[model samples]
Target: MMQLDDETLNAYLDGELDPVVRADVEAALARDAEARARLEALRRVSLLGRTAVDELSRLSVDESLQERVWPLPKPEPDCPAARTGRAMTILSGALVLLLGMGLGAWLFPSSPRLAGEAAAVATAWPRQAAWFHHLAAERRTHARPLVLDVEGSEPARLQVELNRTLQQRVVVPDLSDLGLRPLGARLLVEQARPLAQIFYQDAGGNLVSLLVALDSGPDTRPRFERVDDGPATAQWRRANTRYVLVGEPERVRLQDLVPVVAERTTR
Candidate 1:
């Protein structure tokens, strides 16, 4: 077994290592309790940093900093540069948005109290969704065989298959306007909860993913947030499930699609 230092472990946790090194680190983590514990400690710190970033975003909405953190701007009727810039920004940010944690939910448990649980869910779900998205995208990009018992453009067909396997109603969003068509779904377990990852592809050939999981906590009002998971991800919660949309790195574009996705899936 290769021994990993704190710096290597931290880099592994933050997804700073290259793919080959990362795979080795993962293998090490699986066999090392001490490494896992250290990784968990690092995770707590990362979560704290995310919380601080969230709070800072809330506070800086009226300050100059807001423009830098979130540079979303509406385009004038004739100005194409704003729209082009927005697209470029989202794509560029996607590299930074990649979620660093691997098998996040499976590795990290939620807090016990409702508040703590909710906060944990809030902080973790988006990243988890992002991580799933990256996996799905890689499969698509590499032309890897996706083991789907039911695969098609029809949402109903996919839903029936999902229902049969998951024993839960899976909502399929109509994202045709966004040029994404439903391809299929696969079942997964994360943090001991059922997850339905629905795959789609746009006319432009970009892979899009919608991840649905039962709302484990109270029925809080729907909330939206942008998270970095190697790509720009838009996540929102509905009455019964959490929906995360992962696509090419365009934060503004992702945000614009969130409402359409949220409305369709819930309905």
Candidate 2:
């Protein structure tokens, strides 16, 4: 009898298995309660991911922020008036720049102030990781499901590829003991840094993600937080590398797994 592994069940659910194998799997599922449960778990996870993506798609951008990023164009006046307006605009912009520079210099005379601003931006990784976690879930539900850059079946290759891409040695911890199997991984660019996202799913079909990126900010221990009511995330920095673990709060207590993941990833 052919063993019903996750790969086989997943392929069967995806309609990717050959007819002969599909028939065999179906026949097995009829009598195998465990196999049936696994199949249902996969289906449930997929549905939840799609629902999350749909909710995200329906969200509206803040009107005030939208206007600031893309201001409406004013109606053009006569050529003479337009030229005059353009000159005035340039003159006003220069004045504002000068005034802003003067104020900044007065408020913060040291270069450390500028460095502090950059550090503030670096601290936004938690929110960024949460957003990308949703994005990955969305991609998974598409008709053509997202193809991982590195398949999870080969842990060695996944680690090698991620290390090479990130230019740093990193560990991909085995979460199977925690009932979460590695699904795959993808490389992403966030905040001008290379980010590696490793995807995982539990037996119940709950999705979990781990994101790794190079950090220039100070090191810190795991801090658990939620992002805009989406997923709960645990963020921490080890040395110069930042790690984020994202998952559905209702389904998983991401905080509990944070230290376990953190300890394993520390090399």
Candidate 3:
């Protein structure tokens, strides 16, 4: 009776769920053979990857060194010229690494061009869903205070497929922190319209697909639908943007995450 939903299951996996929910899920997994098997498989893969990384790290060190954890001894300073050059090389490498990390962090967050594209979609997000469709866009980020808040689709991952699906990359990797994974992504382009789509799912495999299509017409009609025939529900808003989420029956649960996501995204 206490089946874990996608959000809760993902939280459990990520060690973020509360004690009550965690205990409930634990009991449910104990009784649900299929769920237990899946969890075991996930854990095995995760542990195997970590073990391999540890082995590689060990291999990086010299095998003959007895004091692997600390310096055993330093050779005499007979080779001053070589030592100075080595010090300079080490310093240069460290500087380069620090610079690379900083640059990577900046570049990883919403690229500037992507921000403009997302903004166009944000304008329409408010009009898509009946719930919170009334929420207006506002300045949120430190750099772009003009960022608007709109509820449409869950922000997840973007898959850029070149040659119509031959190559791809996961654009939004941060959703892993939110107990979600990338389902799929695509860009919607038309003679008069341009839009972006990102999809996400939790551990229980419930998916939310977001469609951000540019408002081609002067006015666009936003709609919401809960499909009885399918495992998905969709909502759209027509402001200066459009957003949609499609998923299994767990979509009702996903609705609860929207306000939480909106609060964080807008803050």
Candidate 3's residue-wise lDDT over 2-49, tens digit each? 875655666787799889878989999888888877777666777998
Query: Candidate 2, 169: how far from true, in Å?
Result: 0.4
What TM-score fits each model?
Answer: 0.48, 0.53, 0.30
Cα lDDT tens digits, model 1, 210-244, are 77877643344333443532555555556666677
Tell how far residue 57 is off in model 3, in angstroms: 42
Better of 1 and 3 by TM-score: 1
- Pull out the clashing pairs in model 2: none
Candidate 1 TM-score, C-alpha based: 0.48
lDDT of 2 at 136: 69
Which segments of model 1 are wrong by more than 4 Å? Answer: 1-122, 147-149, 218-229
Task: Assess the local accuracy of residue 6 in candidate 2 as a C-alpha lDDT between 0 and 100.
Answer: 97
Per model, state how many residue pairs clash. Answer: 9, 0, 9
Off by over 4 Å in 3: 1-174, 216-224, 234-239, 250-252, 261-267
Note each model's CA RMSD in angstroms.
Answer: 21.3, 16.6, 25.8
Candidate 1 vs candidate 2: the TM-score winner is 2
Model 2: per-residue Cα lDDT over 162-233, one tens digit each? 999799998998988899899888887744579899999899877799999887556775656666567777
What is candidate 1's CA lDDT for residue 47? 95
Evaluate model 3: give its TM-score: 0.30
